[model samples]
Target chain A: MEEVWVTGAGMTRIGRRSEPLPELMAEAALAALAMAGLERPEAIVVAAMNPEEFVGDGNFASNVASHMGFADVPTLRVETATSSGAAAFYTGFAEVASGLCSTVLVVGGEKMTHIATPRVSELIGRSIDPYERSYGATMPALAALITRALMARHGVGEREIAAVAVKNHAHAARNPLAHFPTPVSMDEVMASRMVSDPLRLLHCCPISDGAAAVVLSDTRGPVRVAGVGQGTDTLALRHRHDLTSFRATQTAARAAFTMAGFGPARVDFAELHDAFAPFELIALEDIGLVPPGKSGTITLDGETALDGRLPINPSGGLKARGHPLAATGLAQIVECVWQLVGRAEGRQLNARVALAHSIGGLATNNWVTLLEASR
Target chain B: MIPTTVAGIGEIVSYTTLHSAPEGFRSPLHIALVQLQGGARFVCHGAQTRRVRIGSLVAIEAVDNIYYFSSLNALDRARLFWGRAGRAGDRVNAMTRSVVRRLFKGGESGPN
Candidate 1:
């Protein structure tokens, strides 16, 4: 198999948009093509979850391909809930690495703002077991429970969680495409309305409508996909022995690091799945980037800031970048690619390698990808 | 209404904890895959119980917002007592002792 490099990347401004899903996806695809200096792609992979429910349309991949003028190219869809973006990128990478295609375009898009908030909550809750849903165990409820457990077990507090939101929002202030670009104070985060006990409204990623795209080629470039790993666990959280960590994420990260021939100590930066504020801390531990209970110290010390030693979520993460479900994972990859190639603009960090981590459905499925700069 | 029939129901599958559950929910909640008669499955929460055994055919009952299925129903009690006509009368005898204890504790003394 050959190595795969990200030659181009683009994302639509993540916010509530009146534009249709296909149009938003097309815009991102065109932007990526322009960035890559290519007019077409050999293969296309679209990542969208439940477009039927969210946009009243199916065959979303073909629709997007048609809109982007890739009508005759081989196209397919990939869906793994919030990790759909990463999953699609993995597929595209495989296509290029296996010599099936020289270049592949991976696009992840979602139209979540069209639905009502309650309906969105209901749809997201469906990812949980029906029995859990009956007991009112929504995603926020689970995250809240996990947050409380982490706090009690690891001595993490609301202040640490608030620090994550504050830093991400501040970083987003320089990102023109971010939905929530306004920096928030820790006090504002603490005072935000509670969605589920420990998790407040500001702690959760917004219901966003947007798209992100990346072009991958066999030609080596400034940034290359050094490693990719994905793993899954039981969807029902009750079956797991531990609640404080995601076993799937740990396993995926371990495999990714092994494949990349590097460990956390060698990594310069990371983009973690911060669907909820507390998740960043949990993910740091799971991914072996931080010690078991010391992630709180990192957050409290502002180590995750854009200018910190090991900056995290310089694209503002889901907390500020606006998580459009399937699009979030690909967006993380785009951010890492930008940073690795010195194209992150305002939020660029002095880093040569970065890791993008994404979790699907409460960490049941996890995908970790490593991006390294070519010497 | 979809008029979906209740198929073969299974016991509680699995569940998780909601430590930060609003006001009421706090304990490690139990969730199950209730298999309906028509092969359709629905996820549900199990009622508060000391123990939940697999393959235990529990009767489903609803009260207000919650649903429960347990072996402590009238039909189960009758099957344990009157239906077991011969060999193992010891199980009935033990149940009788429990009823006596309940009566002594000023609780309802009925078989169910």
Candidate 2:
């Protein structure tokens, strides 16, 4: 199999926009094509979690392809809840690596702001089991529960959780495309209204509209997808043995690192699924970058910041970059490629290898991709 | 929307406690996966519990006009299961009957 390299990546500013979903997706795709120096791609894969819910449109991949002027190209859609982008990207990579297509375009987008906040919650809540929905258990509720468990089990304080948000927002302030670019102090995060007990409003990622696109080619280049791993667990959290840790994330990250022939220590930077502030800590430990229960300590010690030894979430992460569900994973990958190529403006780090972590439906489906700059 | 009573109680499959909530929700909520007595499963959220052991018979209670099987209500155990059919009408009836028959025939002896 030929090596797959990300030749180009682009994304629109993640926030509420009057523009339609197809337009946003087209903008991102065109930007990626421009970056790749290609007029069109051989194939396209679109990832959209719920265009029906977000934009009242089905056949989203074809619709997006049409808008991008790739109507006749082989097109397909990939959906795995929030990790749909990463899943689609993986599919495109396989297509190119297996000689099916020399170049493939993978794009993800969502228009979540089209609906009311309550309806958005209801739609997102459907990701959980129906029985859980009947009990008013939504994604945020699950994250809150996990945060509580992590705090109690690992002795992670509220301040440490706030620090995660503060750091991500501070980094996002430098990102022009960030949804919430204003840097907030730890006190502000702590004082923010409580969404759930321990989890404040600032701890959770915002609901935004955005799209991201990446061009993958068989041609070797500065960055190659060294490894990719995908794993899934029961959607119902109750079936799992633990709440504080993401079993699927651990399995996926381990597989990815093994496939990449490297460990977490070799990664100069990482983009983890920080849908919730506490999740960063949980994911850090699950991904084997930090020892169990030590993520909170590392954050408190400023070890995951931009200037830290292992910079994490330099694109502000889902916390500040805005999590448009399916678009989030691809957005993370875009940031990784930028950092790897030293194109990330303010948050660039001295890193050759980067990792992108995405969680689908409260870690029910997890994907981890490792990218390295070719020597 | 529908009025349902606590009929039979089952074991606790798993549970988690939330110290914080997401954007719009406030207060800590505890979510649990409870296997009802008749093979029906449900995910419930409620007040925190210090001890949530498996096999504890919990009572279904109503809060905020929502009916949920809450933590163990020791005092209502006898009344909760009394006069309540094993299955929620018929669909679950066949499933539960077959499950019980298989359990006994399979050499698994226990109170139904």
Candidate 3:
């Protein structure tokens, strides 16, 4: 089996931008191509959540290829809702590891800031069950529903959930490209407008427009794709057997750890989805990064801080860093790559192993990627 | 999947109130996941009720393809009826559903 490595990573500022979808994606693609020092990749794996609805573009792979001067190269798009970028990484990694493609360019982008916030919420709601969407269950509404479940079931408190936003913002303050970099205080986080009960505005990630890219090859480098796994579950939250635990994340994390020949205890750092601050806690528990019902409370003790023992979401996470839909998953990998190679300037930490996890559609589909600094 | 039936009373697994309802729905719509007496859990509309606490005994009454819940023992209080709570509900946009179906899939899902 061929070992996969991340040779280069590129990301654009996450916010409302005037650039078209193709142009935004092209910028990231070129940056990654140059960084990887490759003229032509064996294949291209592009990802976007709702280009057709948001930007009125559908043939994303072909347009991105043409814009990047790789029109004739083989290309395809991956869509797994919000986790599209992570799924693309999974696909690109397999292409390289299978030896079918020695080099693969994985790019993901989303231009969401241009649309009205409510419209964007509707677009995001499209990812929910139609039955539930009819009830006006936006991402935050659904997240609030789950957050309520965690609070009721595991004794999670609102203060602990507020702590997630506070800590992530403190970390984002150092990330130059983060959209909401200002470190907000716990009082501010708690006082913010309540979008959904128990989930204030501060706990939610901004709707961002941006792109991120990563180049994968079958050559040894500082960042090796030790393992990647994907998991799927029932789309509707009600259909699932459990509300607090995302079976998808658990399944994906288990597969990733098994493939890497390690366990959660070995992970030095992590970049899990924090689109909703409370989700960070749930994801940590589901991925086995922490024991059940502990991710939330331990967070108050500086356990998951940038300088803490686990350092989950050192890149500001989706809460403060901004979630650009498909770009979020790939950006997570980019952050890991930077951290592994000692280039994460402001939030840099000494670590050889990093984990990136992404969730799509209320934890319906999930991906877990393990990156190592070396063999 | 085997077919099963759920009783009217159960406990609240989790709940949420949506203040920003879409075009077809009214704001401040309350929704919840309820565990039926028979062990089958599902989400339903919470109506005519203020402050539906978790782990409380809730009664359900079905109407118009939507089910509503009340934390009170409505069964005992005789408060259990298809009472009107106005437009605030998971009121399906018939037009939107068809259009969404055409735009995405025959019968598509929200979270991918």
Candidate 4:
């Protein structure tokens, strides 16, 4: 198999935007193409969690490619719920590695701010199992369940969970493209109204509208896609063996590490999926970035900050960076690429190897991606 | 395909009180994952979580094809009877029947 490399990366500011979904996707795709110094790609891969409901559009691959001035390009769409962007990247990577396409354009985005908050919640809630949803289990509700279990099993305090948001918000303060660029105080986070018991509004990501894209090719580039792994679990949470940690994340990380031929020790920094604050700590442990039950301690010790011993979510993560559904998975990869190429500006960190983790549909589908700077 | 059924009694494994619910659901929704006597587990909606605790026994009642969980102890049932006036007797009767069915399903072994 041919090696895959990330040739270019680009993303729009993640927050409430007026631009339509296709326009946001085109902006990111065109910027990535310009950065790669290419006029077009051999194929295009598009990702949108639910444009059918969010933006009232379908046949998204063709729709996006046409809007981006790549009307004749071969294209397809990929969806794994919230991680649709990362799944698109995985598809593009496979296309390049298998010699099916010399160059692939991967773009993802979502526009949900135009809709009512409750309506958006209902659409996103469709990803949950029917049985669970029948009982009114929304995303935050399920996350709160997991957070409570983690707290009970690992002795992780609510303060530690809130700290994840604080650190990410601090990181976002330096990220011009972040949805919430203002750093929030711990007290503010603690006092934020609870969306679910034990999980405040501050602990959850906002409903943002944005897009991100990347250019992948078989040829040499500054950043190599060293490994890509995907893992999935049962849709119902009750079927899982443990609630504290996501088995899908652990499985994806193991596959990614094995493919890269390097363990977590070699990772200089990471962009973790922090859709909910506590998930950062849970993912840190699941990815083996820190020992089991130790992520909270390390995080509170300032070890997961931008300038910490092992910076996590230098892009502010889905927490402060704004999780724009399908846009988030690709945005995380874009952040990794920028950090590796020394273009992250204020939030940049000295790093050669990076990891990006994404969770889809309550961790029913998850992905792990490894990148290395060739320099 | 044969449809499987779940026991009407279980212990609360994990639960949450949601203040921001979906479009059709009411806010402050109390949802819980309950593991039944036969190890079959499922989610249940309920009125309140004030008396509910992890590992506490709950009786599951089906209303309009939707399942809800309530504390099954006698005192809790008595409190429910006294808490409301109209339809109090019907509610108590339903709760007692559910409790009896759960006990029979367990065959004296009770929830773990």
lDDT (0 to 1) per candidate: 0.79, 0.81, 0.83, 0.89
Model 4's C-alpha root-mean-square deviation from the true structure amounts to: 6.3
TM-score of chain A of each: 0.98, 0.98, 0.98, 0.99
At residue A253, give the lDDT of candidate 1.
92
Report how far residue A200 has shifted in candidate 1, in Å.
1.1
TM-score of 3: 0.90
Worst 10 residues of 1 chain A by lDDT: A146-155
Better of 1 and 4 by TM-score: 4
Model 4: per-residue Cα lDDT over A303-359, one tens digit each: 989889999999989999999999999999999999999999998899999999999
Q: What CAPRI-style quality would you assign to candidate 4?
A: acceptable
Residue A77 local lDDT, model 3: 97
For candidate 2, lDDT tens digit of each residue in A228-342?
A: 9988898876666676788889899988988889898888889999999999998999999988778988998999999997888999999999999888899999999888888
Task: Sort the predicted structures by TM-score, highest score first.
Answer: 4, 3, 2, 1
What would the per-residue lDDT of candidate 1 be over residues A239-291, giving only the tens digit for each residue? 56566789889989988888889888878989999999899998888988888
- Pairs of colliding residues, candidate 1: A130-B43, A131-B43, A131-B44, A238-B15, B6-B37, B7-B36, B7-B37, B8-B36, B8-B37, B13-B32
Which residue pairs clash in candidate 3?
Answer: A126-B110, A127-B110, A127-B111, A128-B110, A128-B111, A135-B90
**Model 2 lDDT at residue B32:** 59
TM-score of each: 0.80, 0.83, 0.90, 0.90
Q: Give the number of the best model, judged by DockQ.
A: 4
In TM-score terms, candidate 2 sits at 0.83
Q: What number of backbone clashes does candidate 2 have, counting pairs of residues 3 or more apart or in separate chains?
A: 8
Q: DockQ of each candidate's interface versus the true one? A: 0.08, 0.14, 0.23, 0.33
| Pairs of residues clashing in candidate 2 | A145-B18, A195-B25, A196-B20, A196-B21, A197-B19, A197-B20, A197-B21, A199-B20
Best first by lDDT, ranked = 4, 3, 2, 1
Which candidate tops lDDT? Answer: 4
True-structure RMSD, every candidate: 8.9, 7.4, 9.2, 6.3
lDDT of 1 by residue, B1-112 (tens): 2323322223332223333343355554543333332223344455543454322334444545455454446666677677755532655665455446556856521111
